[model samples]
Target: MNFLGFFNITTVALALMFIGSIGMLVVKKPIDKVILYSIVDAGFLLAVVTFKYLDVAFAIAILGPVSTIIFLMSILKIDRIRHNNREGGPNV
Candidate 1:
């Protein structure tokens, strides 16, 4: 593909990521925001791959899921805390 086409596509992908980040700021749930942030990371990966930046793409591919897993573990911990608190107090 032409570099020009790649540049255009990258612009679109980055725009989507920007919008997704804005959405995440207002999202109420931790898990939902994490998921949306992950999508934005995936969009960056897509742009890197499209631009033939394999090294950057590889790093993003490795780091993205690791972050997602960390976020998921945090969410699980939160749920556990909420469950523990729910026996005699307000819901989380």
Candidate 2:
């Protein structure tokens, strides 16, 4: 790719990450926050890949899915705990 093309791609990725960050800040839902954070991570991946940072890209690619999985798991755990507390049950 040409220099201009690379620059454009990187710029777009940065812009996406910035927008996702703003969305994350304004959102109150845990799911929505996770989605926005994932988007930001995707942007970072795009930027690194476009810049030919293959090692960084691979590392971040692995982290992206792992992080999302962990976030979802935590959210589910919290919801279950809250529900159990509300019901006054100790998971029979």
Candidate 3:
């Protein structure tokens, strides 16, 4: 690809990362934060691939969703615990 094309892709990747980071700071909900985290991960993966690091990009592709799943599960667990406490439900 031409340098201009590479530059455009890199610019888009960085923009996505920047937007995700800003959104993470601004959003109040835990789910929103997790979503933004995934966006940032996607941007990073794109940037890696743009730089021609196929191996690292592959690793990120495999691990990014796993880490996002972990984040989501943690958020769900926390929400459940909070709801139980509020409702006076039995302890898990």
**Clash count in backbone of candidate 1:** 0
For candidate 2, list the clashing residue pairs, or say none.
Answer: none
Top candidate on TM-score is 3
lDDT of 1 by residue, 1-92 (tens): 56776557777788868877987988988878887887788778878898999998898888889988888888888887888797766654
Q: Is candidate 2 or candidate 3 better by lDDT?
A: 3
Compose the digit string of candidate 2's lDDT tens values, residues 1-92.
56775568878899989999999999989899998998899898999999999999999998889889999999888888889999998852
**Tens digits of per-residue lDDT for model 3 on 1-92?**
57776558889899999999999999999988998998999899999999999999999999888999999999999999999999999757
By lDDT, the best candidate is 3
Poorest stretch of ten by lDDT in candidate 2: 1-10
- Evaluate candidate 1 by giving its C-alpha RMSD to the native, one decimal: 4.5
Position 4, candidate 1: lDDT: 75
Q: 2 or 3: which has the higher TM-score? A: 3
Which stretches in model 2 have alpha-carbon errors above 4 Å?
1-7, 89-92
TM-score of each: 0.70, 0.77, 0.82
List the candidate numbers ranked by lDDT, top first: 3, 2, 1
**Winner of 1 and 3 under lDDT:** 3
Candidate 2 accuracy as TM-score: 0.77
> How do all the candidates rank in terms of TM-score, highest first?
3, 2, 1
